[model samples]
Target: MAPEPEEKDGEFVSTGSVLRQVLFGLVVAFSTLMTGFTSAWPVVLPKLQENPRSFNVTDQDVAWLVSVQGIVGMCTSLLSGHMVEYFGPRKLLLINLFPTFGLWLLMAFTSFLSVLYLCRIGLCISTYIIKSFFQAYIAELCQAKIRGAIAALPELIISVGVLVIYILANFFSYEVVTALCAVPFLPLFFLAIFLPESPYWLMRRNRTDDVKASLQRLRGQRENVNNEVKVLTRTSKVQVSAWSQIHELRKRENILPILLVLSILSLREISGQTALFSYSVYMFRQAGVEMDAFLCTVLLGCVRVVTTIIAVPALDRAGRRPFLIGSSVICGTSQLVIGFTLLMEIPGASWVPLAGLLIYVAAFGLGQAGIPWILMGELLPTPVRSIGSSIITFTYCLLMFIVNYIFFWLLANIRLGGTLCLFAFANVILVIIAYFWLPETKGRSLENLEVAFVKRKRLDQNDHDSNHEVTIELPLS
Candidate 1:
């Protein structure tokens, strides 16, 4: 086997090359446009409430509109990695975008709950494709050191898109909102028309010249393209099937990382993140904040956008494990305090919960919100990355559904504080697990991670061999 490439003193690629940066920016913009619907949903809640009778939709029915999106999103997420691997990111992304854009346009005309649900499912599938492909695409493009930073651009743009939609929806009609959603696809359609396929994808296919040309165009370094292509080609092995790749992972020490990714994602969902967003108005109303609940939710969206902006530069600098551990601590504490405030029936307790909730959002934005997706893409080897990422996404979506379902049920039965407390405890557990098990992947190359696992497994095998030899010698007597 060829020796693995070592990180050289100056070989650390930066996202500074103008053309590459422009491409990266375009990709991020596409992600933001794709994600605009998420924040827009909160903004449109009031509109849905205003004409609930016209649509014959109940609060529970509207919630399903959101919930069904989450359901289909999870399903697509679990499957998307394989789709990306099989079909390639460029093709899958382009194919997914048309339906996604079409769904938004269709949603503008739909008053029927069934049609709305179908549109949401289509949106979910598109979002899933976008999320998986975008992450994998960035991962394949950037070097290890700046992977977190590059990966973070999508999340940052997502925040900006949310803020923009929140502002627009505040002033615009539902039709305008639908049009704004469609507008993102127009630019993305043009960009996809010219965008090169991922070099790593080409490498996987053994098209070395195509990989080299792609890297040359994407990185703006014609000479270095061959070197990078050589590195990727050296390690590239074709898997016959997605299931076969997943089975290979099962035979490796991939369990801990998989568990950690799932736990991080589960904690993110179950911690009432979406519940707070979905029911922000109701929570504030109960607290007697006396503000327009829709406005409050929009304000909340603004806060999230601002905090995520702050997180962008800090994420790569602070390292992953610290952010994960620290955020969990903050999230847990905030949830507990908010729960207690609600439970105590303190005067102006609504402010307390609101403040805690904002802090929780900030903490999440700083850490789990963006980090899990980055880590999910980074932790696995190239061969199984698509399958592994999909699995993680699948688990995340399933947990999200369970959490949202339980949250709604609990909100009615136990009230707000009790519901939040459940998430608080879950966050506490996540903190402990993350502290103990999650290794810092900051600045570590993907190849190094693979070697580390391989070496560890070899050491374990040697230990087992020694033990067996000792047992045999003693038994001979």
Candidate 2:
């Protein structure tokens, strides 16, 4: 077994080891940034509609454009787990970039509405796969202490991409903006060539030498990673058939984490994240803000990026549970405020909705935006991690599809305030569930987390036995 690394702030604190992790995290984050670009591409919806050369596009068309990605993502997300297992995240991510790059170009040159929708469909598939791959990739690559922050990098980069597009949409032609969106993939393809394969994945393939080599690169040469290698090697030995894997998922350990993760993701989308991301410009416009909607949307993106940046370090220090609970509280409150402000149409208070939205974005980026993805990587056991993520991502996309598809209908029928009130109510529920149910995964290794989940299930089942004791320890040398 390798000697234990020094501990600081609950993470194994080695500056050299941490620096390597951060560099790899940044390269992977570029792919995530492209997803962000695709998500916020609709910021150009108004421009596309107004351009004489572009196809005639209606509000209905915009809704379809926004919501279609979710449906497309649902189809592709199921394949992500299997694909990651087969091709490995590094190779799959590189392959995904090709379709993504070409699709961006297709959107850049084509003004036809049908072609644009097809391009969006293609991009959605690529991005969903990218999202799933990176979550699994980072989970396997980084140590437990900094895992949350590294996993959250995608969400932060996504926000940066969103902000970049919002600013660029104001200045660039739609063609130029779409063309520029392809830029990330170019560098990411080259940089990702240097990204180390997951030590865990290598272990599962019976490549102990490769696993050790991968771990050394990820952990830095001075660090001993033998103990980590042994742990993964042991995990890899427990291979199972597809039916056995399905049966394994029914166990309390697996079921509990799945339910908890799905709850977080479902609440996230139900609280209107998809609607906000896809239609912020339109949402602000419909809210009747006296301020420029595009500018307001850019400001909202800035808040998202800044708050997520602040949360990155804090994620390791303060822990996941508190951030989630706090975020839900703030998000619910902000939405409630926005709903009432719009409901009353309070004379001389046109800024309230926009202000509330900025508050919402800040709170969301601070916790909700990144935590679920972090938790997804942390909670599931390695044997079940791939398939579990696929199921979770599939459901997430399904919910996103439903939310964006009906957003305008809700706005029209319930009014914007009523619709927002519904989202606020959903957040209030999330606060309660997170407060009581979610586990604290700070500074714990992935292997330790697996044991914790199983013991947690045993404790739940044997509640009457007060004599029973369970202690989950962090990994030692």
Quick one: best lDDT, which candidate? 2
Tens digit per residue, CA lDDT, model 1, 313-422: 78777777788789889988998898888888888555686678778888878886787777776766677777777777787778767776776578789888888788
Give the number of the best model, judged by TM-score.
2
Q: How good is model 1 by TM-score? A: 0.86
Q: Tell me how many residue pairs clash in candidate 1.
A: 0
Q: Estimated TM-score per prediction?
A: 0.86, 0.89
Candidate 2 residue runs with Cα over 4 Å from true position: 1-13, 52-61, 111-115, 236-242, 344-346, 456-477
Look at candidate 2 and give me any clashing residue pairs: 2-227
lDDT of 2 by residue, 1-477 (tens): 112222222335598998998888778877888778878898787787787474687988887787777887888877787787778777888888877777888888886888988888888888889887687788788877677778778888888888889889889887889899987787778888899998877776678899999989998998988767766765554433344457778776666777778888899889997787667877888888989886787788888999999998898888888898899899999989989888888888778889899999999999999898888888877777777888899999999888877887998898889999999999998887776667677776776566555542344433321133333322211
Cα lDDT of candidate 1 equals 0.68
Q: RMSD, model 1, all Cα superposed?
A: 6.6
lDDT of residue 427 for candidate 2: 96
